[model samples]
Target: MDLETLLSFEWGIMMPEFIILGVATVMTLLDLFMPKGLKRKILGWIGFAGILAAIVSLIGLLDYPVTTILFDTFRLDSFAKAFKLILLVGAALVMLLAISYEPKEGLTEYRSEFFYLFLTALLGAMIVTSSGDLITLYVGLELLSLSSYILAGLRKENRRSNEAAMKYVVNGSISTAITLFGVSYVYGLTGTTNIAAMREILLALNDSQSVYLLVISFLMIFVGLSFKIAAAPFHMWAPDVYEGAPTPVTAFLSVVSKIAGFVLLVRVMLSIFANAVTDGPNSTSILLTMEDTIAFIAGVTMVVGNVVALQQKNMKRLFAYSSIAHAGYILVAIASLSLFMFDSLWFYLIAYLFMNLGAFAIIQTLTEKSDSEDSSHFSGLYTRAPILAVAMAVMILSLAGIPGTAGFIGKLNIITGALVREQANYVLVSVMIATTVISYVFYFGIMVQMFFRKAKVKDPIKIPVGTGIVIGVCAVATVLLGIFPNIAFDFLQAQFYEFGDFLR
Candidate 1:
């Protein structure tokens, strides 16, 4: 912690995190001093620019050597660079949507607060992405979780919003406790908070009882982090939270927040648990022994999310369940541990970013127009706003994993990776396929409401320029990535190159 030690470490590699922290601080000051009469949406523009700068800064650091700072509390490597890129890009888009968002009440008075809160949350996610120490990881996790609790209840005037906020905070607190309990066990076992060091110590241990303790810690951590990802048995909070939160915040949760959970998963599971010696017959590592358990969780999550979604009439709840199912698909990649695991996980998250955000933007536009969250609002949308309806169809189809879309390509890679593995996960793969088909019933139901149902209102819904831009960009990207997935895969391989230094 000495100045000499700090000065010796290259600070240039941390520019991305520094930029985000600085932006959040600066915007908080602006929100305080700026005149009440002036437009505050300018904060959104600043946030967007700041996030783009972070992206550029991160790209510059991809060539920098992987290094840890401040007693290994912070680290820079290919894993951080690649995932931080997604976080920044996704935040930038969500910022635009936030600028365009027009909530019914209360939020207008606190418009500027919204922008800085989001940046702070993004900062937390970035911290988790780079953290090498368990304490640093927990701090970042709470930063994101606590900020999300506030964002979920931004509408002071709405009853449902308040209820959603209460539920979110309670569930979040429980999850945090569970995660810390696991971390404490890890510290007791290895006498260190640094994960890389723990890995070295864990590999040397041959005690079966100690390995069982590690497995218990793994389950505790998995159950806790599952709430972050909206995975099943812990996903009940999502439907209510997503239903009540503002549209832009919902998009942030579905894409950016969800991706950050997976980041933590890879960090904790792979770094500390994946390589831990099981010292059992034919089992080289704890992760190998736990694959079947992971697959079971994945299967149940996919089933619960897709099956429950079939009955949801509210748009946000439906998408919440959809997000859960998507998480299950990515978990399949994690469980199978195929050579293509990184490719499948990273690419699916990218595709999910575009596909989910685009759909939410459109949903926001429509629901705000009709003052409803019911599926019926989409009825006769094609006749009222043909272009908007068509774009929505594309997003929904992508979510359903239909061919000729990014979702399809993302799903294909996961299945291919699963089947091509040393021991194919045919059972989990079957679950993925079956649940995806079940999802189609509701996905196409929305399409039917758009194209086949009669219009409830006669006036054509006008789209704002900001929302229009989001829809257009996401739609085109979804299609292009589907046909030319190599564009993403190539950039991914260039930046991460198989995530070798990731677990280190």
Candidate 2:
């Protein structure tokens, strides 16, 4: 393969990154120089508008037959387009929530910067979905990770904010370093960094020792990637970071960051495992070994995340654990890769985004009213803010995988896909069912506090229009998807499975 040929584009791939970065840079400039008043609001609008424009561009242009860009370092297809749309839409909603929550969090001074970082992080995640080479994937992941570290500490004066930032930076650096070392291992084993070329080399190997090189290198890379998604054992940093981060930042971390990490994992595993699996008895492929590893990881992460969450009293920390548990559900989808690689994961993520972020938006708004993050403040919330209580109830129901909500659809798809892979694997099936039951205890625990408990104080909580709009949209999306999941599911299936046909 000629290096020059590998460096290739159509207009479709460049526009998304270009428009997002332009808006982010302009917002950064405005944040640096604009006076502390109404002018800053304009910057926020501009950044939001820019993301809106990019979303339009993506929806308009993302369906043009799969194409390769920058010499195949990036690829454009329905799969990439679908994830980009989800990230952009989520970014837009988070921006509005940030506008409403920033003042309450004492982050009003840096509103423009906040939006700017959000856009940049969105751009990075979009890049992660599009990336087709190791180098491109690394660049996108780091861009997303660095922006998030600062966003985690957006409240500079808060000690927890600084501590979270410090921990994030320290651990992030170590993870990235470990990931780079694994990348080096893959490069050494394959003698190339291009995924397709490396897969070809691994497939050509004829002995177990040679193929073990393939499995070990991939596992090493998965370590760093898994940490980004907050899968258990590597998830120590997430609870404190989510609790300390500004609420919108926490929402972004939980949603956008997880999406990017999953995209990378799906791409890598599919490319490598699919090739090895198809090569037959002559090849020393480790696809089954890899799947077993992923399955075990998925089960443990689901059980541990939910069990730990059951003991948390703080809203953010509770949801932080919930996010980890959700990652396990996502892993179930990924583990079903042998049956269908992308459809179930994409469907689950779209729903997960609305359900999880909607929950966070309500938590942020409630914090504003009570001026607290403790879960106790939610006691008798139905009397104080019935609308929010109802919205939170819907989100919590969805998260708990209750029927008639988006979370239910997401969980249904995952388990159904898992069954497709191994209907008789009672262990995998039983664990998924049991862990989900464990999750509901905590999810409903919050709702019970809101609806069933009597108010300890007489004051009513006021919900801001901006915050309400954010949570309302998410609640509507959750309910809409539940009643008619085909809305997002059709698009996701078409983009991944139907579009996957184009690749073959």
Candidate 3:
């Protein structure tokens, strides 16, 4: 801990996180001293600027060699860089939505706090991406979870918000406890919390009892982490939370929060279980043994999420289920365990950040206008605002995986990834296609309401400047990526190729 030793640590690897922390601190202080009557929306702009700065800083470090700080607890590698870019960009978009957010109720009083909470959550997600140890990963997860819990209940007077926060706390606590118990078992077996060191120990294991313990631990960890991604059976809390939380918070959960969850899952499963060999007559890696189990979970998640969404009349609730179904699609890539896994997952996530957030921006605008969350609120949207109606159609079509949309290309990559495997995962692939078709029923339903139904009120919906920016950017990105996916795919392949060994 001497100054010279501390100086030897490559602190430059942590520039992105440092920037976020600094920004959060400054925003908190600024909020504290600002005039009582001053508009809080300015704080959102400040937060957005900070995230832009952080994104710039991160881009500068793209060529940084694998560097671990604090005794390997935090590592800056290609994996971290790629995912952090998504986190920063997604947070930036959510910040825009926050800036323009105007609920039916007067919840603007806490708008400044909303911006800062998002920064903290982004920090946590960034940390999780780079963390090289279980303890640090868990710490980051909890940081994100706690901030999200508070954000969910920010509409303090709304009973649904209160209930959402309560459910989040209860569900999040149980998941954390289960995850910790699993980590404890892992530490007991390997005698180390360091992921790299534990990988070596687990791979060399020869005892059957130890293998059994490892399997149990794997299941516990998988089940617990499922809660974060809103994977089914564990996804019961999502619809309520999405419906209750502020619209920007809902966008954060769907895009940034879900991305972090998958990052953590990929980090842990690939690093630890990819090489952990089970001792028996037929020896194999732990991940291979559990591939079918993981596929089953993926299948169920897609089915449950899409089927349930069909029944949802609330726009937020419907998108909540949509989020769950998308998680299932990403899990398909994970279950494939192909070399192209990262490429497909990252591409899908980037596309998701654009299309999903754009859709939510429209939902927020309409819901606020009608002062209702009903599907009927969107009736005759084309008659009132044809431009926005067209934009919403693009987003909804993307989500439905139609041709010439980013979501379609993302799914194509995933399916191709699965099919190219030595032993193709036909079952999971089939389930994915079926559920995606099922999802179209709900996705197109939104379009049907917008284009076909008569408006209860004939006035045009006014879009705020911030909302317009978000919708414009997201819509452009969605179509661009769909047509020219190579822009992102090429970059991902190049970057991931260099860090490919880290997963091994």
Candidate 4:
């Protein structure tokens, strides 16, 4: 802890995190001093610029050697670099959405706080990606969770918003407790909190008792963290939260928050359990031993998500279920434990970002138009706003996994990865295909409302500059990535190869 020793450690690898922290702090101070009458939307613009800077900083660190600092609690590796890029880009888009949002009740009073809270949440996600120790990961998770809880309830006068916040806090606290209890078991068994050191210890242990302890701990951790990703049995809070939160916050949670959860899940499961062996006569890695269990959950998640979505009249609630189903799809890739697991997961996440956010942008516009989020809001959308209507169609098609869209390509990659495994996950893959078909019924229901129904009002929807930018970027990315998927795949493969033995 001496100054000289601390100074000797390489800190340059932390530039992105430092930039996010600086931005959040500066925005908080600005919010405190700014005149009450001044437009708070400018803070969102500044936050967006800060995210751009952080993205640039991250790009610069890609060439640096993988390094851990602060007594091995933080590490910069390929996984962290790649995932952090997603977090930054995703946050920037959400910031734009925040800037454009103009609710009927007017969120002007709390706009500045919303902007900075997003930065804090982004910082938390970045921290989770780079963390190399269990304690650091837990801190990052709570930081993100706490900020999100407040964000969900930002509409001060809305009873639904307040209720959403309450549910989130209660569920989040329980999940945190469960995760910590699991971590305690791990620390007790391995006598270390560092992921790498624990891996070595778990690999060396061969006793049946140790194996049983590891299994119990893994179950505890997985169940708790599943709440973060909105995986089934733990997904009850998502629809209500999504419907109640501000549109921008909903988009942020669906994309950035979900990505962070997956990053943490992949990090913990692969780092701690990848080398731990089972207790049977024909011993296997803990991940492989638990594959069936994970697959079962994945199957149920997809079925419940899609089937329940069929009954939803509210747009936000429908998308909430859709998000849950997508999580299940990605989990199949994780369960397969394929060599290209990260590749499949990353590509799908990127696709999800563009398609889902684009859909939300349109949803926000439509819902605000009529002050209702019902399916009727989309009726005769094509006649009222043809261009925006087309954009909505593209996003909906992509979500339904139609060919010539990013979601389709992403699903193809995931299915291919699963089938290529030595022991193919036929059951999980079959379930995914069936559920996807079921999903189309609800997805197309919106389409039918858009194209065939009559509008309650004849006025065209006006798209703001910020909102237009998001929709344009997302639509373009979706089509381009679909047509030439190899662009992203090539980059992912190169990075994976460069990283050399992930989670070792």
Those runs of model 1 whose alpha carbons end farther than 4 Å from true positions after fitting are 280-283, 369-371
What range of 10 consecutive residues in model 2 has the weakest lDDT sum?
276-285
* Predicted structure 2, TM vs. truth: 0.93
lDDT of 3 at 1: 88
Predicted candidate 4 versus true structure: per-residue lDDT over 1-504, tens digit per residue: 899998998889988988989988998999999999899988889999999999999988877767889988999888999899999989998999999998888887898989999999999999999999999998999899999999999999888889989999998888889888888888999999999899989987868999888899999999999999999989999999999899999999999999999999999999888889987689889888888988888898999999999999999999999999999998988888887788888899999999999999999988864456998999999899988889999999999999999999999988999999888888889999999999999999999999999988887688888889999999999999989999888887665455434465
lDDT winner between candidates 2 and 4: 4
Candidate 3 residues 443-493, lDDT tens each? Answer: 899999999999889875789998999999999999999999999978876
C-alpha RMSD for every candidate? 1.2, 2.7, 1.1, 1.1
Which whole-number lDDT from 0 to 100 does residue 262 have in model 4? 95
Clashing pairs for predicted structure model 4, backbone only: none
Residue 93 miss distance in model 4 (angstroms): 0.5
Best by lDDT: 3
Q: RMSD in Å for candidate 3, one decimal?
A: 1.1
Would you list the rank order by lDDT, best first?
Answer: 3, 4, 1, 2
Question: What is each predicted model's overall lDDT from 0 to 1?
Answer: 0.89, 0.79, 0.91, 0.90
Q: Write the per-residue lDDT of candidate 1 for residues 1-504, one digit (tens) a residue.
A: 687887997788789888989998999899889998889988888988998898888888887778888877898988888888889888988998898888666466888888988998998999999999998998999899889999988888888889889999999999889988888878899999998889899988758888889888888998899988988989989999999888899999999999999999988898998778777566578888888988988999999999999999999999999999999999999998888888888899999999999999999988864345999989999999988998999899899999999999999999999999888989999999999999999999999999999998887677877788899999999999988999998888776764868676
TM-score of each prediction: 0.98, 0.93, 0.98, 0.98
lDDT value for model 2: 0.79
